[model samples]
Target: MSDAPHSGVRFRGVIDLDEHKVHDRPTIYVYEAPVRAWHWTNALAITVLAVTGYFIGSPPPALAGEASAHFLFGYIRFIHFAAAYILAVGFLVRIYWGFVGNSHSRQIFYLPVWERTWWAGVVHEALWYLFLRKEPKKYVGHNPLAQTAMFFMFTLFTLFMIITGFALYSEGAGIDSWQAKLFGWVFNLFPNSMTVHTLHHYGMWVIIIFAMLHIYAAIREDIMSRQTMISTMISGERQFRDDRED
Candidate 1:
């Protein structure tokens, strides 16, 4: 007997097996240009901050020559400062985009905590990840659990870092500097600049952890979930593996 008949292939929601024709997948443009730009820029800024921040915490051994001969520590601090400014400015721009950009742009900033369905979706997503559910639901944008994580881990923690970081910067900037003027209030909360430094250091680790989780989730979802994840940021298109509504 001939081998069992091969299952027909489904291409772009249109089943076409015999001809081997190419077809467009069902897709939606979710992330706009500005959102994508901010995403990549923010990622770079975070990476720079993490590396420089690590050096800031545990500096390298002293060089053999004079301090002026090698500005390794100075260069590290400069990079850290530059990346921090970029992160803060990008965050401000992201918030502005949330106001003017598409609906999905605001998802991270606004959590529909009061909605029963949203909480249920969060629970279902959790269960799905726990292997208690057979399938995960498809979403046009971030799933409820992801939205929650973005809000708490990225959004809130970013704000916390900005405040603490600038507070530490104000010490070198002098009491008259604008950074001091604007973020001096942070010092009032912690008083000791060392405490602020410690908090900022911990925040860096937190962001690093968040970045790892975010990347892993995206890659995993791209393969396991019914909807696109990573390509959505690069191409601004979210394509469903199947047309069935979740």
Candidate 2:
């Protein structure tokens, strides 16, 4: 017997016709345009910040005697600050999109608030990834996992950048700097300002890890499901599956 359906004839084939028809293919949609642009731009800014930040954090011993070479450090700091500003702007744009954008782009959908449905969604998403489940449940906006990770990471980076940034800027102040006073409470909470600074420095590694995993997961989904996971962010169109089977 053939697997393909024939006119009014049920084939006693070993394979299930329903399974073949049901698991036909996967679909996705483009749900975020501004988000896509912001993603790449933020990536660029972070790269600049990481490179300049390293140089600023540790000066080379070779340049110890050359005062003129200090100019390089100055320029690096300037570039870092500039990139920080750009990143900040990107964050603000994302926040706005969360409200005014499509249902898929809405922040509330992704940011769970102890609801049963949300928790269930989280579990479903996890199982989908573990290969225990074949298809991911559809959501108009950010999936629960993506939402949670993005929220946590964005908050961490924003606060870290602001606090460490002000601290570094206050290095020139001799007790008269407003930045120092503003961050004094935070400084006192840590072992020392250097500890806070170091934490902020190391936090980049966390961001790097997140980035790697995120890209890998997206690519994997795109390949397995034929969904344009990455492109949807740029094109704002998603190929949604009309029907899904668990």
Give me the candidate number with maximum lDDT. Answer: 1
- Candidate 2 Cα misplacement greater than 4 A, ranges: 1-33, 58-66, 103-110, 172-184
Residue-level lDDT for 112 in candidate 2 = 58
Query: Which residue pairs in candidate 1 have backbone atoms (N, alpha carbon, C) closer than 3 angstroms, thus clashing?
Result: none
Off by over 4 Å in 1: 1-24
lDDT of 2 by residue, 1-246 (tens): 112333454446757466444322334554566877877898898888778877777855555666865676677888988897788777778779978876655663246576888788778878887888767766656677666776677556665676776676666554478867876566667746788778778876666766787788778766664245766766766664344333
The sequence of per-residue lDDT tens digits that candidate 1 reaches over residues 168-242 is 898899999999999999978888888888889899988999999999999999988988899899999998776
What number of clashing residue pairs does each candidate have, in the order they appear?
0, 12
Question: What C-alpha lDDT do the candidate models reach, one value each?
Answer: 0.89, 0.68
